[model samples]
Target chain A: MRNSFYTAGFSEVMHEVKQDPREASYIYTTTACNSPHRGLSAAIGPALFGTVKSVRALGVQLADSTGGDPDGPSPMDLALTGIASCGVTTLLGGGSARELIFDGIEMLIEYGAPDGEPGQAVRCRLSVDGVTDEPLMNELVEQMQTYSPNMATMIRPVPISFDCLVGTDESTRRQLTVEAEPITDRRPAACRVRWVSGTQLVSYPNGRRMLRVDQPKQLTGVDWGPNPQEYLLMGLAADVADQLGRVAYRLTGERHLWEVSTSACEDMRGLLLKERDVVFLQGVTCRVVVPETLRAETGVEKILTAALAQSEVRDLVSRSNPGGVSLVLGREG
Target chain B: MELNGRTAIGFEEGRSSSAKWFDDLTRVRFAGPVSAHHRLLPRELSPETLAVHAGTYEDPVTGCVGTPVFQTSTFLLDDASYSAFADGAMRDVPIYTRYGNPSQWAVQEKLAALEGSRSAIVTSSGMSATASTIFALTNAGSHIISAYDVYGGTYNLLREDMPSTGREVSFVDPNDLAAVRAAVRPETQLLFFETLTNPLLKAPPIGALAEIAREANALLVVDNTFLTPVNMRPIAHGADIVVHSATKYLAGHSDLTAGAVVGRRKFLDRIWAQTLRFGGTLEPLSCFLLERGMKTLALRVERQNANATEIARFLATHDRVAAVHHPEVGGPHYADLARDDYRGFGGVVSFEVRGGDDAALAFMGRLKIPYVATSLGGVESLVSMPSNTSHSSLTSGQRASIGIRPGLVRFSVGIENVRDLIDDLNDALNGE
Candidate 1:
């Protein structure tokens, strides 16, 4: 009377969902912030930490290129991990729906680089055990491509926009708006993979720092870590700082000390309003302080402009890159 | 992929591999009952029809009308079953009898159908059902409000056992809606009350208490054992969960000890998990007995209701009987609520003899037809004194405060010919 996914409890939920589709609708929220204290580094370094709240709060940490933490993963690392994990989860769910029995599955995701390098395709190879039917495995992999949320997010460009408040000094400020064009033609990004069963992470990279995210106190959040917006601002500040360090190093023989502070204006009304014509944040503001010692450098103005221009997270926030998915299979041990 | 009970074929031999990969195969998921018979009966089906047919598992191979007793500990594992375990949804897949069995599924469907609930779980005993429901719904620091006069086992669980585990219980008079409301705390997570109180048969206003529970954002768990689903369906009156000592009426012949919990699947799933942890799973044989016994539930209860009503009337008019307590005899504080809410006033009746404990004992000793025993709700009449039986643990002062007077005799009417029962009662009263 019971199947893999069509459980008794699930049937009840299905019945309720059938009565009201809204019962199945859910909105997921994650909050994040930068690490409280920056580690000692000669160059610009920042660690972004956040919590992913669902039934339980999970801490996620994203280390920038210059500020990598031994326990923390970089943004590319987390994103790739998410893609891989989500792929396995989606595959298992879809296979169960179709009544396919699989003893085990090992997926390998190969991508060109952590950064979205042009002309490199995302490829996936799955090693399956207990089932020899290649066609069914291919069908399941196809379903995984269609059903996985992270896969779909990568395969199609997500709309992104940014409003920024920039200041070279404490007293002066200016606002700028940047909206990235949506990609009409999509090329798939290389895939990432993981193994999962139940709620446990069966196979994962060892010894990574976890970023914790939670709701605000009003929403029963423990205030243990930052909310999602704080995480975005945190990452942005670090990325800009890293870029500034690079630009300064390129111009001068030594790394210069600099401080970057970031904030965003969030509208509660926008969150409460209808989906259309509503914006969660009015804009994000980043203020950069150039050391008095470096202020006298001839190329200081150009370095500041170039740092903001070359920041990877800045480009990520201001643009769209739709990724794609591919699949391969092998024998399981 | 054999259908019989066994561990997975290929994965069983590996203990040296990653434990995480093989953990799903080792652990059993309590997915609640999965049965095709569930919800097959229409909402409008009469109790009589539901009792007989709602949960009957039909064998596809033999076309057997009855549920086959799946008397095994575990089930064979295949791809579909492995998928079930991997997804944490081993329900109805029969991974282990403790997690689920066709026999348990059959009875659970019947109970759910009878109670008009989304699902039901069968436990080893009534206390198991009650305990699991309480522990599952409330957290460590949570508060519970229950009747002071609840079943001795439940009262003991709350009063004696629960406090050690950090749950505070406040015993309130179920009739006092205002007191019940006042007892609610921000931490209160559940309100536990019996539909009809044991020994006294006091009828709590279920609808009003349900209202209080809602306002307090607490779950209303009613023990519907006395009324069963035949006399009253507590869920219809807004009870969030209903527990029953199926050892009594539901399994009317008293051949098996079992408990049932009926509620929304969400709550029942949590309770089912707790039951598994508590190790209160009924074995396959007992499940079979309980299922077979429940088939005639409506028929047995219909007769007990009528028989008890007549005995209550007879006791009310007797000179030797100081008082008679039955909902039909207008003894409960909320007689009007009982009249309006219940289809039948149930089978138990209690009365106080004129001369207190000694006289009551002598009269019970003189009875010919009924057995002088502890439990109730059988085909044969059974009688007991609360002072010596159910309430013996309570202090004299505690007993007096709750109106458990010295001579109170609890009578569980059976489905016997009323004329003979009345004659025996008359003879016992005469001290012959």
Candidate 2:
């Protein structure tokens, strides 16, 4: 279809190279433990902690929660936050696209058990306001689960590649690459969850800067922000909470109050000592709670049950790794 | 009961203190690129003032009077960005340069203001804008109706590329409302036409085409590159989307190449998504240049309009000029519609030399003021013969069949002294 004349016309001898103009490849980068003041300097207050810088040079301090007391938010918190934010936003956008109107939406995340002990899984409680159409709310939940990128990343195995660049100087740079092992077990781990702590700065392709910090010395952070795990739990809660109100309303045709609580268990040995049998994150648990007014209603339990079943984040953590992470290490001299 | 407009959720009303953390998680930065930073002015003000002041991003931090170039490739992502990507609303937030940019936003705001549209999207080139709008609005197996005399690039896209992509196009005379109406297939998704066709200066009945499109449930997309918004805004005349080769009139200088699509927010969002996938996002520097160029759009187009009118009058009676084509020149072709819809005839005037292609080439070679160039709407005048340039893709027979003669020279008049331009034309036309 390059050039076809309706009538017979002279043809030119030419060779052309062409590709689909619409397809493109995007790349994201992050440098862990980079100096705080360097790059865009997104660091808050004194740069006493290790920070991570993205390719765009935006840097934020990292909180190490692997030992003793926590510092700030660890990396996992940010990941969870990403998932939650993605879920909520996806719901908002999808709702708008469908022209489904509603009111205030919020999610409450409960990481561990009420007694502050390691839980079986992460729990999230979702709540919504305004319109209550059980069917419409149900559809929205389905849409959010299907569309949310972070939720999808969690539920489906993501192909991740890690490259290690080790070097004392640019001239002495060397590279190492590693492929992640396949998971043979989908069952929950027998061991309890051991939290890993660290602070990090992540820059997205779209100029977004995020810094994760934890509580004071009690938790290991200076209270710059929520800890990494908090962010993750918060994200899961937000994701499930995004449409629960609508789901409840759609199911019962009456506005119902509810929230999402989520938790996750991890085995410290697998994360710290390279134990093949221990899963770093054993199981993620999620529960939905309704207000006292709706506790007696049979539909309340139905809606709550439906929400947990439909929770994208729960599916992400409960399932075995669906994708592989490949790591490549390189060093600069 | 109503939190914003709808009833507030009971649990969120007594939100826990930790709920504050969700602020960063659920915030949405911009509604979309164009309207997020738009500065409003009295619509009663002149287009010239709107061109200069509308869409100026007031820097609260530095109080910068003009839009500064946002040179970075990525913005600081937050919950808004995360949310935008989740819901197919990437156009609403600034995340990546390709997805959206503040610089692009500033220019888009200005363009939307000038076109009297609710939103606009800037692209790397005019063709990209056109292509994105077409591909986004219409699905595969859709049909399009356009003029036979549309710009050569557009003609090639429809004739050569569209069918292969599962879309069909029908070429017809835009003035023949009956033929245009008759050409609408049940699957016709759009009607594309130039407000002023290239070289020939043929004007389409936009209002009538819009009505036809309405009846057929099709969109009317007008390429308003030549007339621009200063002379005429096709959207006001019922065009659903108005596209421009900012490389030409909108940018007002040959220094940069850019494009714009202006219409409703819903349509612009879809077009923005298509443009993102097409990889035709305008760079920040180019966006800045375009914004700067458009500030003087009203002024530049006014001067070009006056000068082109004078040039057409001079050429109409000249001995070497066999025929002249301009909306203002006496002819029944689209005169009523032009007078009714256009505030001013555009800056381009197409005329035929007494001889054919060679004489026109010789006359162009004799010209001193205007450059021998392919594009129009620059501040500097440009002269090109259709046979040698824009319509070269068409065989002579095909060109003639479309009423483009051998000696048809398109004169894109610039802001030059009309008397000096007349003398230059006189000297060139003498060809002694």
Candidate 3:
């Protein structure tokens, strides 16, 4: 006997075994599937794939090979890629998404490794570019934080475990293991690695390297206090390059090598101690080595002037104290 | 009243006309050779001498021979055409005070000339200038390589705030050329440090750092706050950008807080745009004060430098002093960088007192002339214990690793009578 039942705008029992064999079989199946229109999936899937493919295609090869593992990108390199890619993608896709036009995009990334750490200890820099409107550009940059995958990864702290081994001799072996808590607090985390012989390697997860005993030769004449403002340094340089490049391209329709190099010194003690409010004394020196042809067409000073005037990050880091509280921690032997 | 035709004609038509008055004022204040002074001086003079003379324009109204304070906040335009001039649509026109005023431009011109930079922009405070520069240069998700030890405010901005915006920073030792080179990736943008560090007084080897930064294709930024341009010119040593916390030494009076970034015109233009948008421009009155302060900078800094050197020497020999960290006093090998990068020793000295924090604080309390305060680069001497004062926020372990002991004292020497200063220090250290 066949029976009919109605449930919330649908007929359940109407699909009886003999009357609706296919519908009953579908309901009984273990695997559930909801199919979309072929045309829609095909169009949307390709567009998404194309967007990601375009981003990956724009990668630039780093010239140096020492900082990271030989086989893969170092944390610093990954960070750079992450920042650059996020900026580029956000600027490009963000503008298209919002129905705006952007002539060009430029980004710069900078970071520092902490003492006794194999990866980046400090990460700071700026990203500046010309857009249609100043306010709109700022809004896009702000919104990008919510969407940038790489940036999201950086803000979330990851659990880190370290395994240290000493002695080069095959027969001799010593291992030290330490696990650090997730870095939720903004204060610098001081961690100590005690060498079996009582040698201490102090590491600040968020602070910079002041001195290293293993590499004492490199510590000569360095002021450990006035270190660089990590992000500001990169921002200044990148902005300079961007401005110079824009001027050059506008004037000559060609892109030239526009580079900036920056460095600073800081008193390590002041940063680590609670006495000095200012720690690193950041300094940036840029040499815009332009092609001779472009240099001739656009006065070097003029180009440089435009570049300096155009830079925003240089103005910010050089202007005020971006606010924060300082904290100190102790590592015991 | 008798109507005199001759006098009326003279006043209204020819000799005493409004045109004549305008022409006379223009000749004295804005005529050919006088207006040319702005462009010519920067090109012809050396930075050291220019720092002293760049903005000493005689007052048009009073002939004061010093840059006068134009305290007005707005300017009256001559006609409706001035609207375009005010909005940067026209060049070389005086329009609004916010865009550019005579007083502000005078200081800007002086700073640019003194730094031997293409141009410069002034801001309300040191940090504002720094922030403007950074904002102009970078956007979200950029990379930078920085020295490990940095100003606390800047450290926090980079470490905590910048990451939220997608920017990343790496801190490394400036002295480590290999490390600096290693730190640079394809997207690395800039490197930064100070010419002479504050409090700790460590000096970086600019030449080597510049070389490393160049190889990595990054811009080098030098903070000339402590040393001032009088002691060191980072540009001459291959710096791309130079910044100063003018509140400390450049202003000399402790009255005004200002900052400046000096670099090539191309880069400065970007910074200028950011400054305008951010509204961090230095007021005209502050610019006048800065100009006034600059006139005596050479004299004040010279005396201050001498005083600091003397004090550093005195502290080195003191029985209460354990170790002095002045770059000049250290061995040739220890401070070889000072010889290469700096022309003179700066006015900051860091030393460890014999006693710990309690005794250090007591010594500071005993001092009469030197104020026991925070902030350096004032005309009056200042002293403070780092472990308890400047770096008190840091953890004890962090302090120990960096060699900041509880007994450490950072002294900012001023241009006061050296004999009296020495006597005050002696009494304090001797537990008077």
lDDT of 3: 0.50
* Decoy 1 TM-score against native: 0.61
TM-score of candidate 3 to 2 decimals: 0.53
DockQ of 2: 0.01
Worst 10 residues of 2 chain B by lDDT: B2-11
**How close is every model to the real structure, measured as TM-score?**
0.61, 0.56, 0.53
Interface RMSD values for all candidates:
14.3, 29.0, 37.0
lDDT by residue (tens digit), candidate 1, B1-432: 345422222222211122211111222222235544333576468899999988777776687778888899987767656655654455546778888888888889889989988688999999999999988776555688999989999999999878887689999999998899999985677899999999888999999999999877678999999999999998999999999999999998868899999997667877887899999999999988998888989999999999999999999999999999887778447545647688897789999988999999999999999999988888889999999999999999999888888889999999999999999998998897
Ranking by lDDT: 1, 2, 3
The global Cα lDDT (0 to 1) of model 1 is: 0.65
Q: Comparing 1 and 2 by DockQ, which wins?
A: 1
Instruction: For candidate 2, give the lDDT of residue A250.
Output: 64
Model 3 Cα RMSD, 1 decimal = 27.3
Q: What are the per-candidate TM-scores when only chain A is compared?
A: 0.54, 0.39, 0.30
- Which lDDT tens digits does candidate 2 get at residues A91-207? 443444343443544333233324322422333333445447656655665555544444444544432221111122233223322222332222221111111122212312112
Most TM-score-accurate candidate:
1
